[model samples]
Target: MALEIHNITFDCADSRGLATFWAGLLGWNVYYDDDPEVVVAPSYPNPGMGLLFIPVPEGKTAKNRVHLDVAPDEGTRDEAVERAVAAGATVTGDHRKDDGTGWVTLLDPEGNEFCIERGAAERGPRTSTAYRIG
Candidate 1:
């Protein structure tokens, strides 16, 4: 038997707006934002990892319980971070280790936490942020 992740869903305040933020952030396109309760990926045939944006209104009082640790598939780590920063995301801070093993934590449009870093294959140096799932 094997375990696989199907989708990462966010209970945000606005599905459409948040979807746009993430769509631009991850180079993902909208699946379907026409529905209120759900929005599938419209821009992709199968968004490798389905990113869902659902609606919630509690207002993210505390920090996120789960966070994404993302790697850049394009160019350098610095370039990847810049792209995210330009796409409606703000850098919370840098949390790299003295060994250069840390990640940049950024807040999405609705203030969700995610990270950007170099690919594990290259491993020139690595940076990681806190991440867990239940």
Candidate 2:
């Protein structure tokens, strides 16, 4: 037997709001939205994992041990970061390197940390090649 992941749930103060933010960020659609919970996924009959937001009594007090790292599907890293900021995300740390590498850490509306990395187009082509020697 094998197990498969269904959804990644986030315990939040406002499930609908958090789910809205995530849905907008990921360009996913909200499948369900009730008082205590909200579910967002790519589409009906989606084969991949979805996001579920559940209401919680407590607020986030410390840093998140687990976080999501996002890469743009069409634009540059800077563009994605800017969009996130515009959507109410706060920049917690800027880890981008001068060499155009590294990622930026950001806190979502509820203070959940996530990262933005360079997109495939922004990274361009590899400058060096790897070789194996025995």
Candidate 3:
């Protein structure tokens, strides 16, 4: 038998709070929310992707192993950066290229790293390192 991924869980200090942040960012409603735990994006009437939040101490430090990379839904990458900054996300750094071949990496209100690439890059040609298996 094979396994399927239902959701992605994030270890956080407050499940409900963090879930609120994500729900706002993703425009997704709260699937389930309480004091200690929160499950965003419940399957409900249909299947759903999980965005779980669990409580933990210690604030985030250093880099994240897994980060969310997002491009702007409207306007250019720079515009998106402004929007993100306005949304309470911190600017980790700016890596835009002269030729517009780069993206901006951002940190959430809780210090989670996520990237925003231009729509062009999102749809541009991709270079793969995959090898065909015969």
Candidate 4:
């Protein structure tokens, strides 16, 4: 038997707001929107590996131990970063190299960390972890 990831859950202060931020960032749609819990995915009928946001009384106090690394499907990394910033994300670090390699780290509206890396069309052969560190 094999197991697959069904959802990546986030404990946040505002479930709907956080889910909306993620849905816009990932070009997904909010499938479920109920108080204290909201879900965002690529689709509704068959939402594969959705992002689930649940309300918590407390706010984030520290850096996230696990974070998401995303890439654009049809744009550059900088463009993606710009979109994220417009969607209520704050840039925490910019790690792009002189040769145009690396990722940008940002915090979501609720302070959850995520990264924007080179898009599929822009990435070449990844030889080492030189671009992984930020």
Candidate 5:
């Protein structure tokens, strides 16, 4: 038997609010907005993985050990970063190089870190050393 990923859960202060932020950024819809938990994902048929926001009493205190890296389906990374900022995300780090490589790190409304990478159009073609981590 093989196991599949259900959802990526997030512990937050306001589940609905955080879910809204993510939904807007990803162009996904909010499926569940009930108390205790809020879920956001691609409409219908389910996209295999969704974001689950659960309310918690405690607040985020440090950098997240695990973070999501997203790439735009259309437009440039700068455009995606702008959209994220307009939707309540804060830019934490700018790692874009002069040669049009790298990504931008951002913090969601609840301070959870996520990154925005070059879009498909911007990336063009994948190379052997495209994602080499130093």
Candidate 6:
């Protein structure tokens, strides 16, 4: 018997401004706001999986069947998509590639969508080779 994944809600109209834009883009902290809901996390007994932001009336029409693909543990990936467009986010899609691999589709700030790969020191080291199923 095992089942986890405490939070990951987000159905927002402004639950403390999308939990302060995802607690300043994952620096996570907002333990909990008010007015409906808003509870980011990365500490305080956080065993991983947290980010609530409720309060939904009706918005974000269509798109986003399930998203959130960030990858910058530090930098790169166009500087984390220019720090997520200077923390307001909105570059609907860019799918960077030309030998740099791809990923860069942001939206946040109430638009939803997410994605901005290329971390792990900007995807260096890992000659590649993986296909196992036994």
Q: Highest lDDT, which number?
A: 5
Better of 2 and 3 by lDDT: 2
Estimate, for each residue in 64-130, the C-alpha lDDT of model 4 and write its tens digit: 9999999999979999999999989999999999998899999999889999999978897666765
* Tens digit per residue, CA lDDT, model 2, 95-116: 9999999899999999999999
Write the candidate numbers in order of decreasing lDDT: 5, 4, 2, 6, 1, 3
Ranking by TM-score: 5, 4, 2, 3, 1, 6
* lDDT of candidates 1 onward, in order: 0.75, 0.88, 0.75, 0.91, 0.92, 0.83
Question: Which residue pairs come into collision in candidate 6?
Answer: none
Tens-digit per-residue lDDT, 41-69, candidate 5: 88757567899998989999988999999
Candidate 5: worst 10 consecutive residues by lDDT? Answer: 125-134
Could you tell me the TM-score of candidate 3?
Answer: 0.76
**Candidate 3 clashing pairs, residues 3+ apart or interchain:** 7-50
- For 92-124, candidate 6 gives per-residue lDDT tens digits of 779787999999898888888989889889788
Cα-based lDDT at residue 78, candidate 6? 93
- The top-ranked prediction according to TM-score is 5
In candidate 6, stretches whose alpha carbon ends up further than 4 angstroms from where it belongs are 1-35, 45-52, 61-69, 74-94, 106-111, 123-134
lDDT of 1 by residue, 13-129 (tens): 988888877767666677663576544453456555677787876888888999988887667666778888887889998986777566789998889998887666546644677
Query: How does candidate 4 score on lDDT?
Result: 0.91
Candidate 6 yields a Cα-based lDDT of 0.83
Give all TM-scores, in the order shown. 0.75, 0.87, 0.76, 0.90, 0.91, 0.36
lDDT of 3: 0.75
Mind sharing the TM-score for model 6?
A: 0.36
